[model samples]
Target chain A: MSETDLKLPLDAWHRAQGARMVSFARYEMPIQYEGIIAEHRWTRESAGLFDVSHMGQLVIAGRDAEWGLEALLPADLAILKDGRLRYSLLLREDAGIIDDLMVTRRGDHFYMVVNGATKHGDIDHMRTTLPSGVVLDHMTQQALLALQGPKAVDVMARVAPGAEELTFMTGGGFDIGGVRAWISRSGYTGEDGFEISVEARNVGDVAALLVAQPEVKPIGLGARDSLRLEAGLPLYGHDLDETTTPVEADLTFALSKRRRESGGFPGVQRILTELDKGPIRKRVGLFVEGRQPVREGALVVDAEGSEVGKVTSGGFSPTLERPIAMAYVPAAAAVPGTEILVEQRGKIFKAEVAQMPFVPHRYHRKGASA
Target chain B: MSVYFTKDHEWVRVDGDTGTVGITDYAQGQLGDIVFVEVPEAGRQVDKGGDSAVVESVKAASDIYAPVGGEVIEGNAALADEPSLVNTDPEGEGWFFKMRIADPSELDGLMDADAYRAFLADQ
Candidate 1:
C-alpha cells in the first residue's frame, strides 16, 4: 500500500488512456483498457501492446559471471551464447522452485528477468549467495513493453529494421528515435513478439509510438492472463511456488543438457533424482465437461471420489471456446485421454487429462512448421 | 407493459399470462463479454427469485434468478453459441426465457420501468 513499493513506468500513459487501474503484485497496473475479451481476441488475431514494466530486470556481472550464476540456478549459464535467452528456474536446496526467470547472455553481463511478485526475494537471495567478485545490479528504472500477435514482427519492422532478423529468444540493443532499448523476441502470451526494455523516462514516448500503429491495440493485464492461460504457460504464484520443483512443475525443458550433466547448479542432485524417478504429481491440462468452469484450489478426485491432487489454475479458454484448466494430478493419471474428476462446490465434474496448450501455440520458431 | 426487477438483476416484462425475462444492462456490463448462457429448459417450474439459469463470461460465472414465479414455456437457444447477443441486445434478442405466469396477481408486486430506472441510479 506504500507509495515506495513499486510503480510502472507507463502509469501516466495508462491513466491518459482511461485505463481502470488495479493493484497487482506490489505494482499498480491497468486491469483493462477496452475490455478483457476484446483485448484477448485482438492479440490472437492482430496485435496487442502490453505494459509489462512491473517485471524485474537485473544485471549479473563479474569476472566469473557464469560460474557465479551456476551456483544459484539450475541452468548452464556458461554455454548460453550471447544475445540468446534461456528460460530457467531458481531452486532451493531441496529442489523446490524459488522463481521461474529468463536468463539472457548479453556479452559479459547476464540479464535476468523474473516475476514482479517474487523479484524482491529472488534478488536478495542471489546477492547473498553470489561470490564476492560478482555484482547484482537491479534495473529498477527500466520499462518493459510487449507487442504480441501474428503481426507483431511487421509492426516492429516499420521502425526498427533489425528486429525482423531477430529470432525467438534472441535480443540486442537498438536505438529507436533517440531512445536506446534492449529488445528481445520473447513474451508470455505464446505469440511472436518483443519485450523492449527502455529507460523509464522515455517509455511513455515509445509506448505511444507503438500504439499509434494501425495494427496495435493497447492490452491490459486481464487479457495478458487469459492469453498465457490458453497458451498453457504457468503463472508463478498460482501454477508454481517454492514448494514445487522444476520437474514437478513439468518445466524440465528449461534445463539444458550441459547443465544436467555438469550437476553444478543448486539442488541439482534432487532435480536429477526427480528427472530419473518420475515426480509423484505432474502438472496436466484438463478439459472440464460442464458449463461450470472449475476455479483454482478445486480438488481433483478419482473414480471413487477420493482426492488425488489439487487444481492450480482453471478457467474458460476463450480461444478454444470451452472450459479448460491446469491441475497437478497423480503422474499415473497425467496421460492424455485419461479420465479424471474435479470437485468444485461439493459437486464432482467430469474432466479428462489432456495435452498442454489447449489451443495450438503459434510461436515464431525459425523453420518450424506452423 | 410493466417491467419488474429482481434484486439479482433479472427483469421481467409481464403481459397478462406470458412474461418475458432477461438480465438488466447493469448485469451485462458487470459480467463483461458473456461467452455462454445456460437457459433453463422449457416447461421447468421456477419459483420467484429462484436460481434458474447461468451466465458465463470469460472471467467468471454467475447464476440468473427468476424475476417472477412461473413455468418456462420457451427459451432462447440461439444464445448457446452466440452469447455475445446478450451484450449486444440484453433485452430483445438476448432475452433468456419466456415463462407462463403462475399467478397474474403477482405482477402487482413488480416494479415499473420508471422504478427500475431509479433502481439503477441508486446502484
Candidate 2:
C-alpha cells in the first residue's frame, strides 16, 4: 500500500473482520473477506454489506440550487419530484463527460454522489463553472455503506422498520439503532438494496449492527466490481472518462426531453446532435466463448489483425459462469449478435455483441407487482 | 520418486528422467480462486525459469514458469474443464504438466520438503 493512501473510518473494523485490504482509488479498502466468488454468491442469495466511504458525497445548496445544478448537468431538475433521484453526467463545453453522478432533490438542496477518484477534479470544475452565489459542501465527515441483494430489504425492515416503504431511486432519513442515517433505496448492484449515509465516527457501529444479523455479511470491492460488471454499470476512469460523451457511452437517457429541447446545459448542441444523428461508435457488451477472461486494455481487432477498439471492463462472471466484457466498437458492430474479435496477450478470442445487464436486474421498482 | 520445490512456488516430482510439475498448496492459497489455466503443448521445449504456462484467478493472471528445463511430454487436460482443481488439490491431480528432465543438475538447485517449509515460514 502507498504511504499517501487514505484510510476509511472502519479500517480497524475491516481488519478485525479479517478483510484483506487493497488500494482502490487511493484508499486502503477491503477487496475481499472470505473470497470474491463466495461473497458474490452470498450477495446474490442473501445480503452483503459494503463499505463505500471512498466515494464523494456532496450537498449543493443555495438560492436556485436546482437551476444552478441544471446548468452543469443534463437532468430535467424542474420536473424531478422531491425525494426522487436522477442519474446524470457532468459535461464539458465540447460534450466530454467530467463525471457521472446521481442527483437527488431534497427539501431545499440537492445531494450528489460522484466517483471517488474524480471527486477533487469534479469539485474544482463545479466551483469554477457554477455561479458565485451557489454553494457546494463536500460531506467529507460522512461515511457511506451499501446493504445489497435479495434479503437487504428484509434486514432493513428489522433494523430500520420504514425502509421497505421506499422503492428504487428514492431515499429518506431513518433512525437505525439510535444512529441517524440517510438511507437511499438504490445501489450499483442489479439487486434491490440501500445506500446508507452516516457519520464517519458511527459507521463502525452501523456496520456492526447490520452484520450482526443473520442475512448480512460484510462484502469487499472484489465482489462489488463483479456485481456492477454483471449489472453493465460503467465505472468512471475505466468504462468512462473525460474523452467519452454520454451519448457514446449509451447514457442518453440521462438527458431529459425538456433539456434537449431547451438546449441550455453544457455541450447541449453537440450532445443533442449526436442524440439525433447517432454517434460514430457505441459502448456495447461482449460475450467471450471460453473461460479465459479478456481484461481492460485488450484490443478489439478486425479480421486483418488491426486494432478497431478497446475493452474497458471485463472479468469472469461468477454469476454467469462465463467471461463477459464491455467495449467500444464501431456503430455498425454494436448490434446484438454481431461477432467481434478480441486480441489479448498474443491470443485472439471470438466474441459477440450481447445486450447489457448480462444478468437481469432485480430492482424493486415502484408500482411493479411482485 | 523425489519431490523438489522452487523459490517461485512450483514443485517437480521426479522419477528417472520424467518430471511432474505443479504449484505448491501455499501458492494456490495465496492466488485465491483459480479461474483458468493454460499449459504448453507436448514437444515444446522450455528453459528453467522461462514462462511455460499461465494460471488466472478472478483478480489477475500470473505466469507459471518452468522449474527445470525440459521438453513437455503432456499437459493436464483435466484443468481445462475445471480450473478449481488447483485450489483443491494443487500437488496431486492439479499437476500442470509432465516433461523429460533436460538437465539433472537443475534439481540440485531446488529445495527439499524441510527447506521449503522453512522458506515458506520466512516469507
Clashes of each: 0, 0
Query: Per-residue alpha-carbon lDDT of model 1 for A15-74, expressed as tens digits?
Result: 889787778998888888778888999999998999988889999999977888888887
- What C-alpha RMSD does candidate 1 show over the true interface residues after superposing them? 2.0
TM-score of each: 0.89, 0.98
TM-score of 2: 0.98
> B1-123, model 2: which lDDT tens digit per residue?
999999999999999999999999999977878899999899999999999999988878889999999999999999999999999999999999999999999999999999999999999
Interface RMSD over true interface Cα atoms for each candidate: 2.0, 0.7
In angstroms, give how far residue A276 of model 2 lies from its true place: 1.9
Candidate 1 clashing pairs, residues 3+ apart or interchain: none
Chain A TM-scores, candidates in order:
0.97, 0.99
Model 2 alpha-carbon miss at residue A18, Å: 1.4
**Candidate 2: misplaced stretches above 4 Å?**
none
Error of 2 at A225 (Å): 0.9
Candidate 1 stretches with Cα past 4 Å from truth are: A1-7, A290-292, A366-370, B6-8, B16-20, B40-52, B65-76, B97-123
Q: What 10-residue stretch in candidate 1 chain A is worst by lDDT?
A: A1-10
- Candidate 2 residues A204-318, lDDT tens each? 8999999999999999998999999999999999999888899899998898999989878999988978888998888999999899999999999999999999999998899
